[model samples]
Target: MAVITGGTRGIGLATARLLAAEGADVVLVSRNADEAVRVADDVARTTGRRVLGLAANTTDDAAVGAMADAVERDMGGAHILVNCAAEPAGQKAVPAPSEAQWASLASHMDTKVMGYLRCARALLPGMRRAGWGRIINVSGLGARRTGDVVGTIRNVAVVALAKNLADELAGTGIAVTTVHPGLTRTEKVDAMLEARAKAEGHSTAEVEASMTQNLLMGRLPTAEDVAQVIAFLASPLSVTVNGVAIDVGGGVRGSINY
Candidate 1:
């Protein structure tokens, strides 16, 4: 079974669908109860696999713990966890951010960094008992590049968190890894592009082309593209790739990650 936080949309939703289609019982977690159940039911109907939607705010320790307990009681236990419950990054850059912006950054960390840790802590017991598990952290390419300060920090922190967990869990059957997806084409990105095109008096296609000129692939990856990578990392095939961060951003031009 897989428990995916932030599983109602974007990469999380995509991952849930892919995992369910692959025959894994999936639990879609969101802060909003109605949306979570609705999406889970939709995925179940489409994929013909068991899918449950639960509500939890990852930033809250009690909520995360309760969610984990419910998953164990309702559907055996979670063998895989994908942490993607974070607010979208890309806040306006400031030379010196005000108190509120700084607070926002802290909130991001609480949700992305500490929140990942909390969920892992809650579900790890089942994994340990099963003697095998996969924990995939959904970080971002902002961990590699600059410009978005909050994005960079929180994503980098997630990488650090995954590495630390991987090291500590070495020799155990559990593997922890991080995936950094670049600006992928999700619903949110589509909406943003449409708004930008309207404001700039250009076609949405033109705006997208302008934005993606730096990509060597000449296009943005869809959420499904990223989900494929996550599914691999969540499988037994990923045992050799623990503690590593994989980039699923198609390809960026003129820069090398290594």
Candidate 2:
């Protein structure tokens, strides 16, 4: 079974659905119990795979512990973990941070960086016992290229964390990696696009096209596009690939790296 935080929407929800379709029983973890359960039920019905939802605030130690306990009791343990939880970036203003912005950025770090660590540590014992596991951290392209301090710092921290975890668990059966998604076409991105379209007096399609200009694929990636890669990393097929970041951004041209 797999446990995915932030599984109620966007890339997390897409990942859950795809994982379920591939015969993995999924535990969808969200801060909102009702939303998590609702999405879990929907995935279960659609994929005919066992899916459960449990609520937990990643930023809270007690809640994360409870979530780990519940997963152990209900699902026996998780073989895969995908860290996909984060507040919407739109909620915060950036581009030129002020002194007062430091506190907000620190809070963002606590949630994205520390939250991921808490979940990883909580579930490591179970994975160690199972002798096989995959932990995929859903970081963003901001790790490689960014225009804001909040995005860059948090994402780079995730990459660093994943690398360290991979090194610490090198001889074990667990494989840790990070996936960087860019300009993913999700409900959240669509909303942003629409708002920009309205504000700039340009069609939504035009704005979307502009967003894809830097990508070799010439189009924004769908959530499913990134989820497929996540599913692969969670499977036995990805046993040899560890401690690295994969770009699932339809190939950003200027940022190309070997």
Candidate 3:
């Protein structure tokens, strides 16, 4: 079974659906417990696999611990874990910003980076006993250093954590890796573009055009695009592939060491 945060929407939702399609029972975790269950049902119906949706804030340590226990009892111990939950902190103004805005970025880091740590620590015991596990962190393109301060830093921290975990867990059959998805075609991204356009006094098209112009493929990466990479890494085939960040951003100008 796979336990994924933010499993009700965007990349998280896509990842859950794809995993179910590939014959894995999934547990969708999110703040909205009701919505999580609904999405799980939808995934189960679509992929013909058992999907358990649970509402639990990723940042809540107790919540995470309880969910981990539930995962073992309800869906069997989660062999695969995907940390895709975030505070969604892509919004920013280039030149000037406020303290509250900075806190927002910190909050994003707390929910994701710290949340990943909490979940990994909680689930490691089961994985260690079984001698097999897969942990995937949903980082993003420009995670290394893309001129975007908070977002870039957050991604880098996640990638660093995954790499470190992979090294530490060597010979434990636990693979830790980060998948750096490029600009994904998601409602969240669209909303960010709209806000940016308004702030910059440009049309949404103009902002989008500028954003895509940097992509080698000239298009936003689809959720499926990143999901394919993640799906492979989660499989037994990628047991040897560890401590690496796979970039899914249409070959952007800046590259990170994988």
Q: Return the top candidate by lDDT.
A: 1
Task: Give the alpha carbon lDDT tens digit for every residue of 16-118 in model 3.
Answer: 9999999998989989978988888999998999999898877889999998989878766888888999876555453333323667667878887999988
Residue-level lDDT tens digits of model 2 in 138-249? 9988888647778888999999999999999998899999999987889988888999999999999999898788789888999999999999999999988999999998
TM-score of each: 0.96, 0.96, 0.88
Candidate 3 clashes between residue pairs 3 or more apart in a chain or in different chains: 33-55
Q: Is candidate 1 or candidate 3 better by TM-score?
A: 1
CA deviation > 4 Å runs, candidate 1 = 91-100
Residue 16 lDDT in model 3? 91
Model 1 lDDT-worst window of ten: 91-100
- Give the per-residue lDDT digits (tens) of candidate 1, residues 145-220: 8666778889999999999999999888999999999988899898888999999999999998998898887888
Which of 1 and 2 is ahead in lDDT?
1
Off by over 4 Å in 2: 95-100
Stretches > 4 Å off in candidate 3: 92-102, 190-210, 254-258
Model 2's C-alpha root-mean-square deviation from the true structure amounts to 1.4
